[model samples]
Target: MDVPALLDWFDETARDLPWRAAGTTGWGVLVSEVMLQQTPVARVAPIWQEWMARWPKPSDLAAATQGEVLRAWGKLGYPRRALRLHAAASAIADDHGDVVPADVDTLLGLPGVGAYTARAVAAFAYGQRCPVVDTNVRRVVARAVHGAGDAGPPSTTKDMADVAALLPEDAAAAAKASAALMELGAVVCVARGPRCADCPVFDGCAWQRNGRPAYAGPAKAVQKFAGTDRQVRGLLLDVLRDTDEPATKARLDRVWSDAGQRDRCLDSLLVDGLVEQTPDGRFALPGEHGAVSPRG
Candidate 1:
C-alpha cells in the first residue's frame, strides 16, 4: 500500500493541530476526540485550547460545576457530550487518580467512552498499536483495500479487524500509521471530490484500479439542524447561557414560536440534566439556578 510513501506524506503535511503537539497529555487527546466527533476541526481547536487552559487535568474539570462545563462548551452543538465529558472527568478523578487511562479496556469503562474513542485514546495518546477506525479510516479502507467506493453500514467487528490488519507491528509506528491513514482519508480520499492525483498511494489504489465506481450501498441519512428539535434546544440553552440568573418561562418562550415544541425541548433539556429548574419555576443552566454569577 506504499506505506512509506503515505507515512512520509503525513510527516510533511499533517496539520499542526494543538492536540497533536508535543507534550499533550492523554487527557488532552481524550478531549480532542470527544470534541472532534460530528464537529469540524476548525470549530473544535479553539474550544479545545480554551478547555485545556481552563482545565489542565481531569481533577480540575471534575471540580467544575456542570454549568461551567456547558458554558465552556459554547455552541459546539450536541451539549450532551459536554455533560458526558464532565462525568468522565469526575470518574477519572475519583477512580483513576486523575490520570486518563492508557489502556483501551479501562478507557471503555469511562462515561461516553465507546469502542472508537477508547481505541483512539490508546493509539494516539498512549502510542499503542491498536486499530482506531473512524469514518475517514473506514472510507479509506473501503477504497484502498476492498475496491469499494464507500463503506456501507458500520459493522464494528469487521471495521476493527480491517484497520487492525493495516497497522504496523511496532506500537509507535502503528500509531503513526493510524494517524496518517486518518489524515489521508480526511484531506485526500474524502467522501466527495477525492484528490487521487495527490494521494501518496495512488498507484496502488484498488478503487482506481476498478475505475472508481459509484457507491451503490444503502443511502446515508443527511442530518438537518434547522427547524429540528436540536435547533430549538440550542435556542433555549442560549438564553440560559447568556443570563446570569434563571430565565423565566416567558423568556424561554420568546426563543421559539411553537409553545408545544418549546415546552418539549425545555423538558428534554431538564431531563438531560443540562438545565435545572429553580424552585420559582425559572430555568438556568445546571448548577446556576441560584448562583451569584453563572459562569456562562
Candidate 2:
C-alpha cells in the first residue's frame, strides 16, 4: 500500500475539521473525540468550535458545573456523554494536571472514553502508532481490504490488527495514514451508497472488483421516540436545561402528559446525573447554580 501517497492525498483533500487542524490543543482533540461519537461531522463542527472557544483547556472545563456542560451539549443527544465528559475533565485536572494523556491506557481511563477514542487521542493527539478505527474506518477497511459490504458490530482485536498492518513505519506518518483512511471511508467509501469514482484507493479496492455485495445480516433494532420514555426524558431535560434556576415540578409536569411516566423519567434523570432534586423539592439540572438534595 502506498501509505505515503494516501497520507499525501489526505493532507490535500481531508476535511478541514477544526479539531484536526494544526496546533489544535489536546483538550480540543478530546472534546472533538467525544462529540463526534455517533454524531455527524457537520453537526459536531459548530458545537465543537463553541466548546473549544469557551473552554480552551481541560482545567477550564473542570471549573464548569455539569449543568453548563450539558447545556453546551445541546440536542446532540445521549446526554450522558456530556456528564461523562465533565467527569473526565475533572479527572484530567486533578490527576493529569489538565493535560490530555497521550497514552492509550490513560486516555481509556477517562470517563466515557472507549477503544476508538483512546486510539484517536493516541494517534491523532500524540502522533503514535495506534490504529484509530471508528465506523467509517471499519467500513473502508471492510470494503477496500476484505471486500465485505459492511463491518459487523465492533470486535476490537481483529479490526485493530487489520488497520495496524496498513500503517506506515514512521509513527507520525502512520497516524496521518490512519486519519486519511478514516476520511476516505467517511466521504468516499460510505455505506448505503459509495462514491467509488472519487475513491483514492479505487484501483486496489477489493469490493469494487467483486461488485458490492448487499448486507444480509440482522439489522439492529431502531429506537422509537414519539411517545416513549426517551421523549418524556427529553421534554423534562429541555425545560431544565433552558432554565436559569431550578424549575418547579409544576413546570416540568407541563412538558409530558402522564404524571406517572413523567415522574419515572425524572427519577431516571436523577440516576443519570442529568438532573437533581432541589432543596425546595423542585427539579433542576445537576449543578445548576442552586442547591439540591443528595441522590438516594
Candidate 3:
C-alpha cells in the first residue's frame, strides 16, 4: 500500500483535533487515546479539552480522589475507565516523575494501557515509529490490503506487524503514517457506509480490485444497551454519583424496578470499587480526601 500517498491524504483531510495540534504533550495524547477507545470523537472533544484545562499533567490528575475522578467522568459510559485513568496517573506521578513514559513497554506496564495504547503513545506521543491499530485501522487494513471486507477478532502481533510494514523508515513520517491509517479508517474507510469514492487508495486497493465482497467470515454482534445489566448499572451509579453522602439501599432501588437485576448491578458496582458501601449499608463513591505526592 502506498503509505506515503495515504499520508498525504491525511495531511489534507485529517480532523483538526486539539490533541493533534503542535506542541501537545504526551499526557494529552495519552488522555485522548484512552477517551477515544469505544467512544466517539465528537463526544470526547469537549470533555478532553475541559479535562486538560483542569488537569494539565499526570501529577494534577493523580492528586484527585477516586470519587472526584468518577464524578468528572460524567456520562462517558464504562466508568471503570475513569478509575483506570486515575490509577495510571498515580503510577506516572509515583514512578516516572509525572512524565508520561515514551517507550511502549513502559506504557504497557501502566494501569489499563494495552498493546494498542502503548504503541499509540509511542508512535503518536513520542514519534517512535510504532504501529497503532484500532478496530478502524484493522478494518481499513483488512479491506484495502488483504482484500477482506472486515477483520475478524484482533490478533495483536499480526495487526502490529501488518501496520508496521507500511511505515516509512523515518520516525516522524512513520508517526504520520500511523495517524493516516487511523484517520483513513475514521473518516474515509468507515465500517458502515464507507465513502469509497473519496478513498485515496481506490486504484491499488485489494478490495476495490476484487469487487468489494461482503464480510462473510463471522457475524458481528450489534451492541444493545437498553434494558440490559449495563443500563441498570449505569442508572445505579448515577444515583450514587449525584449525591455526596451514601444513599440508602431503598433510595438506590428506585432507579430500576426488577429486584434481582437491580441488586445484581449494584453488587457489581460495589464489588468493582465504583460504589462504596458504608457500615450502615448506605452506598457512595469512594471518599478518600488526600493524595500522596510523587517523589522528586
Which of candidates 2 and 3 is the stronger one according to lDDT? 3
For 163-257, candidate 3 gives per-residue lDDT tens digits of 98888999999999989989999998998899999988888899988889988677878899999999999999898779877788999999999
Model 1, 60-134: lDDT tens per residue? 999999999999999988989999999999999999999999988999999888988999999999999999999
* lDDT (Cα, tens digit) per residue for candidate 2, span 107-225: 99999999999899888888899899999888888887888788877779999999999998899888889889989878888877798887777888888777877665568668788
CA lDDT of every candidate: 0.91, 0.87, 0.88
**Cα miss at 294, model 3 (Å)?**
27
Clashing pairs in 1: none
| Comparison by lDDT, 1 against 2, better one | 1
List RMSD in Å for every model shown.
2.9, 1.6, 4.0
**In terms of TM-score, which candidate is stronger, 1 or 2?**
1
Q: Model 1, poorest ten-residue lDDT window?
A: 287-296
Candidate 3, position 119, lDDT: 90
* lDDT against true structure, model 1: 0.91
Per-residue error at 142 for model 1, in Å? 0.8
Q: Is candidate 1 or candidate 3 better by lDDT?
A: 1
